[model samples]
Target: MARIERVDWLMVDLAPKVPRSDAIQSFVSQETPIVRIIDSDGAVGTGYSYTIGTGGPSVMALIERTLAPLLLGREAEDLEALWRDVLFVTHATTVGAITAIAMAAIDTALWDLRCRRAGLPLHRLAGGAQASLPLYTTEGGWLHLEQAALVDDALAARAAGFAGAKIKVGRPLRQDVVRIGAVRAAVGDAFEIFTDANQAFHVDEAIRRARAYQELDIGWLEEPLPADDIDGHARLAAMTTIPVAVGESIYSPAHFREYLQRRACSVVQVDVGRIGGITPWLKVAHMAECFNVAVCPHFLMELHIALCAAVPNARWIEYIPQLDAITTQGMRIEAGRAYPSEAPGLGIAWDWAAIDRLAIGAGQVTLGSSGGKR
Candidate 1:
C-alpha cells in the first residue's frame, strides 16, 4: 500500500488570451489552486480547482492547514474514505465554496493516483461508455462581442467541425433575440445554437427571453436564473420548450438531486472542480442518468473529456481552453467531437517550468511531518 508522504500546493493566475465576458462577470483571470500528493511508493498525482479571481489564498490555506494534515499517512487508494474524512473534519464549513473547492483538489489528486496505479486511462477505469463525445464551442460567444464578430465566429466554429456553439444572452430582450437570430442565420438551420445568461436574468425576464429564443431552434438555455432559484427555473422550464441547463454554480450532489427531483433543469452541467472532484462528479452524473437527464459538463474540457466518455448519459463537453500555456498537451478536437487520451491517469502532461514561472507568490504551501505554512 502506498502511504501519503507529502502534499504541496501553488496558486497560479491565468489570464485569458482575450477577455471573456458573460452577463454577471467579466473573467479577467483565473485563480487556480493546484495540489500535488506524493506517496511512499514514489507515485505522484496532481489535481486542481479554479475561481474567477479571488479566494485562491483561502483555498490554499485550507488545503495546507486542515485537509493535507488529515491525508498525512492514509492509503492512497481509499479515495472515498479519505474524501469523507476531509468532509467530516471540515463539516462546519461544508456546503459552501471554500470547503468544496479545497475538497476538490484533494479528491481529484487521489483519483489521478488511483488511475495511474491501475495503469489505465481515467475513462476506461471509470467505465469507458464511449470513445469520443460531440463538441460545442463557447469561446466565440462571449457577451461583449459585436454582432458581426459573433456571426463570424459562429461561422468559423461551424467550419471547424464543431456541432454547436453557445451564445451569451441577458442583454436587452430585443438585442439578445437579434443576436441569436444573427448567429442562427449565419450558421443556418442545421447547426445547433445554445444560449447562456450566466444567471443574469430573473424569472420573468428569463421566461420572456426563452420564449423569444425558441424561434431560433436553440439547443438549451443555461443558467438564466440564479442557481439557487430552483422554483423560478422550474417555472421557466415549464413555460418553455427549451431545455434548462445548470450545475456550474452548484457545489454538491445534494443540490443537483434537489434540482432533478424538482425538475428545475434538463441538462446537467457538472464541473469537476466545482462539485468537489471526479468522485462526486461521477455520482452526480449517474444521479442525472437515473432521472433520465442529459449531462453537458461545464469547463475544464481537457480533464472533462475523460469523465464525459466514461458515462453513457453525458452529451456534450464545453470547449474552453484554460490550461494552454501551462500544459504540454491538451484535449484534441476533430470533426466536432473530443476523444480522451489513452495515456494513464488524467493524461495531462504539465509544463512544470512554465507553471513555476507563472506561479503567484501569495498562495504557495508545502506540508510534511512538521506541518506547513500557506
Candidate 2:
C-alpha cells in the first residue's frame, strides 16, 4: 500500500584532474544529479540523470517543478502509468535533453522501488543468472592521450582484472591506427580490445579503419558512423570480419527495431536513460536476443550490470569508475567484473550530504513548467 509520497532532486559535480573528450567536445568536469523518491512507507529509492555542467540546474528544475507535482499522491505500484503520464504531458518537448533526462530520474527511482519491494537485486528480478558481471575499462581511447599514456592505460586495465578495454579512435587515419596497434601489442591479444569512433567517420573511412585494426584481433568497432546511418552500418557489418556496433544515441525501441531489422551492427549499445527506462530497456534486451545480436550497453554502467547478467547475449558492460564519488556503497569491481550488493533496491544509494553541497542556483528551475517535465 505504499505510494510515492515525495521526490527529491539533488545535483553533484565532480572535477576531473584532466579534460575528457570525444569527437565533439572535451569535459573538464561533469555533473550527475541524483533523483530520490520516497514512498508513503518511508522507503527511499535513488536514480540519476546524465548532464553537463550548465544543464544540471535545468534538469533538476524540470523534475522538481514539472514531474514531481503529478506523482505527489499516486500509487507507487502504477509505475508504467506514471511513466506514460509524464510522457504524454511532456509530448511536445520530447525531442531533447530536458525530457529524457527527467524520465531517466523517475524511471530509475521507480525500478529501485520495485527491487526493494521484491527484496531482490535488480539483476535477479530481471532473471539474471550471475550476481557478478564482467566489466571492461572505457575512456581509454581519447585522442588527447599520448601513445605511452594509451599503452599504460591498457596495461592498467589488464592489471585491474578487466577482461577487455575500449578506447576512442576518430582521429586522422594513421594516428588512430598507431594507437590501436599499440594497445593491441600491449594487451597481447588475450585481452579483448574494442574501439569507438563516436560517430566520427564516413562509412568508407570507418570501413577502412576498422579493416586496418581488424588485424590486431580487435573485439568490436562501436559507433563507427552516425547512429542514423543504419544502411552504412549494415554495409560495414557485412564487409568487415570485425563486428560493427551501434546505438547509444538512439532514443526508442522503434529506433532499435529499425537498426535490428536492417542488420545494422553486430553489437547493440543501449543507454538506460535515453531509451526510456527499465521497462523499455528490458524490451530492447529481449529484442537483441531475438536477433542474436550482442549488447554492450553505453555508460552509467553500474545499472546495466544487472541487465547484462539477465540477458544471455550481453557481452560486456563498460566501466568508467568515475561515478563512485557520488554513490554510497560503491560497486566493487573484482577482476574486471562488478559484484552485486545485498542492499535492497538498486544496490546503490545517494550521498545526500555531498549532493546538497553541489547545488548551483534556484528558480532557474520552475515547479510544474509544462504539463510536467519528463
Candidate 3:
C-alpha cells in the first residue's frame, strides 16, 4: 500500500465574473483553500473548499496546524478511516463550517488519490450511476438583477440549452411574483423555474410566498428559512406543494438525517465542501435516497458533476462556474444535461500557473519516522 508522503495547501482568491448577491449575503470573492496530497509512489491528488468572502485563512490554518499533520504517513487508501481520525482529532470544532471545509480539502484529495490509483474517473470510482444529469442556471439569477435583465438572462439560459433557471426570491412578495411571472412568460411553462430565498424568510412569510409561487408552477422553493430550523421547514413543506430544498448551509450527515427524518426538505442541496467531501457526501446522498428525496447539489459544478453522476437520486446540478477562470477544462452541457469527464480522478485540469500567480500563501509537510519536511 502506498503511504501518504506529503501534504500541502494553498489559498487562492478567485474574483467572481460579476458580483453575485442573494437574500442573505453578496459574494464579493471566493476564498478557495486548496490541498494537494502526495503518496510515496509519487502520485498526487488535488482537492479544495471555498468560502464566500472570508474565513478561508482559518480553513488553511486548520489544515496547516492540525489536519495536515494528522494525515502524515497514513495509508493513502484508508480514506474513511483517515476521515474519522481527522474528525475525532478535531472533535471540539466538529459540525462547523471551518472544520467541515478543512476536512473536505483532505478527504477529497484522498478520494482523488484513490480514484487515480485505480485508474478510473471519479464518477466511475464513486458509482457511475449516470453519465450525465440535467442542468439549471443560477449565474443569471442573482438578487441584484433588474426584472428585465433577469427575464432576458433566463431566456438566454434556455436558448443555451438549459432545462431550468433559478431566480432569487426574498424581494417584496409582489416584486418576486412579478419577476417569476415575467420569466415564466418569457420561457413558457415548458422550462422549469426555481427560486432560492437564501434563508431570508420566516415560516409564515415562506408559506405565503410559496403559496403565491405555486400559481406559477415553480419547480422548487429553496432555503425559505434558516437551514437549522427543521420545524420551520417541515411546516413550510406541509403548507405548499413546492418542494423545499436545502443543504448548502448544513455541515454534517447527522443534520441531513434530522432534516430528512422530519420530512423538512424535499430536495437535498448537498454542497460537497460543506458536507466534508465525497466520503460523507455519499452518505448524505444515500440517506436522501432512502428518504425518497432527490438531490440538486449547490454550486461548484466543476467537481460536483462527477459526484452528481455517481448517485442514482441526483436530480439536477446547479450551474455556477466559480472555477472557470482557473481551470483548463470545464463541465460540458448539451441539451440541458451536464456530461461528466472521462479523465481519471476528479477530472479537473487545474491551471496551476494561473493558480500560483494568484496564490496568497502555501505550506507543506512531509512524512517519515519523525515527520520530515522537504
Candidate 4:
C-alpha cells in the first residue's frame, strides 16, 4: 500500500480574453484551485476545481486547513475511503458548494494516483466504457453575442467538424426564437443545436420558450428552470417533447436522485467538480443509466471527456475551453468527436508556470512526510 506522504494546493485565477455572460452571470475568470498529492513511493498526481470568479480562496482554505491534513498519513489504497473521510468531516457545511469543491481536489488527485500507478488512462480507470464521444461547443453562443455572431459561431463549429453548438437562451420569446432560427438557417438542420437558459425562467415561461425551441428541432434545452424546482422541471419536461437537461447546479448525488426519481430531467449534465469529484460523478452517471437518460456533462471538457466516455449512457461532452490558459495542451478533438488522453493517469499536463503566474498564492501550504507545514 502506498502511504500518503504530502499534499499542497494553490489558486489560479485564469481570465478569459473576452469576458462572457450567460443568463445568470458573467464569467470573469476561471477561479481555479489546484491540488497535488505525493505518495510514499514518490508518485505524484495533480487535480483541480474551478469557480466562476469566486470562492476559490475558500476552497483552498478548506483544502489546506481540513482536507489536506485528513489525507496525510492515510493509506491511499481506497479512493472511496479517503473521499468519505473528507466528506463526513465537512458534513456540516456540505450538501452545498464550498465543501464539494474542496473535496473535488483531493478526490481527483487520488484518481490521478490510481491511474498513474496502474499505467492506464482515466476513462479505463473509471469504467472503460468508450474511448471517444461526440463534442459540442458553448464558446460562441454566450448570451451577450449578437445573433449574427451566434450564427457565425455555429457555422464555424460545423465547418471545423464539431457535432453541435449550444446557444444560450432566456431572451424575450420572439427574440430567442429568431436567434435560434438564424443559427439553424446558417448551420443547416444536420448539425445539432442545443439551447441553455441557465435557470432564467419559471415553469410557465420555460414551457413557452421550450415550445418555440421544439419547432427548431433543438437537441435539448438545458437548465430551463432553477435546479431546486423539481416539480417545475417535471412539469416542463412533461409538457414539451424537447428533453430537459439539468445537473450542473445540483450538488449531491441525492439531489440528482430527486430529479431522476421525479422524472424531471432527461439529460444529466453531471459536472465533476461541482458534484464533489469523479468518485461521486460516476455514481450519478450510473444512477442516470438506470432510468435510461443520457449523460452529457456540463464543462471541463479535458476531464469530462474521460468521465463521459467512462459511462455507457453518455453520448456527448460539452466543450468549454476553461483550462487552456493553465494547461500545456488541449484535449484531442477530431471530426466532431472528442477522444480522451490515452496517457497514463489523468493526462492533463498542467502549465505550472502559467498557473503560478495567475495564482493568487493565498492559503498555500505544504505538508511534509512527517506532517505539518514545512
Candidate 5:
C-alpha cells in the first residue's frame, strides 16, 4: 500500500513590484506557502496556496495544526476521497480564504501527485481539452502610473508578442475612456484590449465607464464594482455592450451562483486560490460552463493554465511576469499565448532553495494526522 508519508510547508517571499491599482489591499511582494507531499516510496508532489501579507499566517496555522495530522499515512491514490475527507473533518468552519488556502495547498499537491504518477502533464492528467491556450498581458496596466508610462507599458507588451493587453481603470469615467482610447490607438483595433476596475466604482459609475469604452472594443470590464453588488453587476452587464467580468475576490460557489443566476457577468474570472483549491475551482469552472460564460481565470496563473486547458470554454489567461522571480522555471509566454509544460506534475516546480532564503517565519502550516472517521 502506497500511503502518504510527509507534508512540508515552505514559504517564499517575492521582491516588491508595482502595486495593483484599485484594490484596497495589495501585496508588497508575493509570498507563496508551498505545500510538499511525499508518498511512501519517496515520490514527491508540490502545490502552492495564495498568500498575501496578513492571510498567510492563519492559512499556515490551519494546515499545520488542523490538517497535516489527519493526512499522514493515508493512501496517496485516493485523491478525491482525501479532498472530501479533509472537508468533512473541517466541515463546520471550512469557508473563505482560510479554507481556500488550506484546500488549495493540499488539492494542488494531490493533483501534482496524480500527474506525476501518471507521467503526464497536469493538463493531460485532468483531461486535456486543448493543446495550447491563448494568453493576454495583465502586466503594466496600472492607473497609478503616469499616462506616458502606462502607454509605454502597453506598447512594450505588444512588442513583446502579446496579442492582447489589459489596463487598469476606475479613476473617473473619462480618464478610463482616454486610457482605453490611447491603448487602442497605439495597438490598433486589431489587438485585444481589456480593463479591470478592481471593484473601485459604484454601480452607476461602472455602467457609465463600460459604455464609454465600447468604441475602443475593450474585451471586458472586470470587477467594475464590489463583488457583493449582484444587482450592480447585473445592471452593468445589461447596460453595457462590453462584457462584464468578475470573480477574483468572490469566496464561494454560492457567490458564483448569484452571478450565474443573474447573468451578472459575461465572463467568469475564477482565481484558484481565492475560491479554494482545484476541486472547488473545477466546480466553479463547470458552473460557468453550464451557464455558457467565458472564463478568464484571475491569477496564480501557473495552475490556471492547466485549468483553462482542461475546459473548453476557457478564454484568455492573465499574464503578470512579476511572479517569475519567485518561481524556479517560470512559465513561458510567447506571442501572447501561454504554453503548458510537459513535466510530470504541474510542470514548473518551486525554487525551494530560493523559498528557504525568502522564508520569514511569519506563517505556519499544520495538517491533521489522526486516523479518519471511517
Candidate 6:
C-alpha cells in the first residue's frame, strides 16, 4: 500500500486563446489551482481544477488548511474512501464551488495514483468503453460575437472536420434566430450546431427560444436555464423538443440525481472539475446512463476526455484547450473526435518549468508528511 508522504500545489494564471464571454459572466483568465500528491515511494500523481479568473486563492487555502492534512499518512490507494473523507470534512462548505474545486484536486490526484499503480491509463482503468469520442468546438461561440463572426467560426470548425460547433445565444429571440440561421446557411444542414446560453434564461423565455431552435435541427440547448431551477427546466423540457443540456455549474452527484429523477434535462454535461472530480463524475455519468441520457461533458477537455472514453453514455467531449501553454503535450484530436493518450497516467505531460514561470507568488504552499507548512 502506498502511504501519503506530501502534497503540493501552485496557483497559475492561464489565459484563453481569446477573450470570451457568456451571458452571466466574463472569463478574463482561468485561475488554475493544481495539486501534486506524493506517496512514500518516489512516485507522484497530479490533479487540478480552475475558476474563470477568480477564487484560486480560496481553493488553494481550502486544500492546504483542511483537505491536505487529512491526507497525511493515509493510504493513497483507497481513492473512494479518501474522497469521501475529504467531502465529509468539508461537508459544511460543499454542494458549492470552492469546496468542490478543492475536493477535485485531491480526488483526481488519488485516482492518478490508482491508475499509475495498476499500470493503466485513466480511460482503461476507469472502464475503457471507447477509444475516442466525437468533438464539438465551443471556442468561437461566445455570446458577444457578431453574426458574421459567428458564421465564419462555425464554417471554420466544419472545415476542420469537427462533428459539431456550439454558439452562445442570449440575445433577443429574433436576433439569436438570425445568427443561428446565418451559421446554418454557411455550414449547410448536415453539419451539427449546438447553442449555450450560460444559464441566462428564465422558464417563459427559455421555452420561446427552444421553440425557435427546433426548426434549426440544433443538437442541444445547453444551460438554457439556471442549473438550480430543476422545476423550471422540467417545464421547459416538457414544452419543447429541443434537448435541454445542463451540468457545468452543478456541484454534486445528489444535485444531478434531482435533475435526472425529475426528467429535467435530456443531456448530462457532467464536468469533472466542478462535480468534485472523477469519482462523482463517473457516478453522474452512470446515473445518466440509467436514464438513457447522453453524457457530453463541459470544459476541461484534457481530463474529461479520459472520463468520457470510460463511460458508454458519454457522447461528446467539448473542445476547449486550456493547458496548451503549461503542458508539454496536448489532446490527440483527429477526424472530428478526441483520443485519450494510452500512457499509464492522466496522460498530459505537464511542464513544471513553464508552470513555475506562470505561477502566482502569493499563497504558494507545500506540506511535508507532518502536514505542516514548509
Over 177-264, each residue of candidate 2 has an lDDT whose tens digit, in order, gives 8888888888896999888888888988987887788788888888888887888888888888998887788777788988899887
Give the CA lDDT, 0 to 100, for residue 42 in model 4: 90
The residue-level lDDT of candidate 2 at 59 comes to: 74
Highest-TM-score candidate? 3
Q: Model 1, 19-40: lDDT tens per residue?
A: 7999989998888888888888
The candidate with the higher lDDT, 2 or 4, is: 4
lDDT (0 to 1) per candidate: 0.88, 0.76, 0.91, 0.87, 0.77, 0.88
For residues 208-284, what per-residue lDDT tens digits would candidate 5 score against the true structure? 67767888888888888988899988888888889989999886888998899998998999888777677778888
lDDT of 3 by residue, 242-345 (tens): 99999999998999999999989899999999999999999999999999999899998988999999999999989888888789977888888998888889
Best by lDDT: 3
In model 4, the worst 10-residue window by lDDT is 365-374
Badly placed stretches (over 4 Å) of model 6 are 361-374
Residue 74 in candidate 1, Cα distance off native in Å: 0.4
Kindly provide the TM-score of model 5 when superposed on the true structure, using C-alpha atoms: 0.92
Candidate 4: residue 78 lDDT (0-100): 86
Local accuracy of candidate 4 as per-residue lDDT tens digits, 93-154: 98888998888888888999889988899998788998799988899999999998998988
Q: For candidate 5, what is the lDDT?
A: 0.77
List runs of model 5 lying over 4 Å from the truth: 362-374
Give the per-residue lDDT of model 6 (tens digit) for 1-374: 87887788777888889878988888998988888888888578888889998888899889878888788779888888988999899989978999988888888888887788778999999999998998989888888889888888888888888978998988888988998988988999898899999999888889888998899899999999888899999999889888999999999899999999999999999888899989999999999999999999999999999999999999998998999999998999998889998998888789999998887732323335344343
> 1 or 2: which has the higher lDDT?
1
Q: Please give the distance, in angstroms, between residue 206's alpha carbon in candidate 2 and its true position after superposition.
A: 1.6
User: Residue 236's C-alpha lDDT in candidate 5?
Assistant: 82
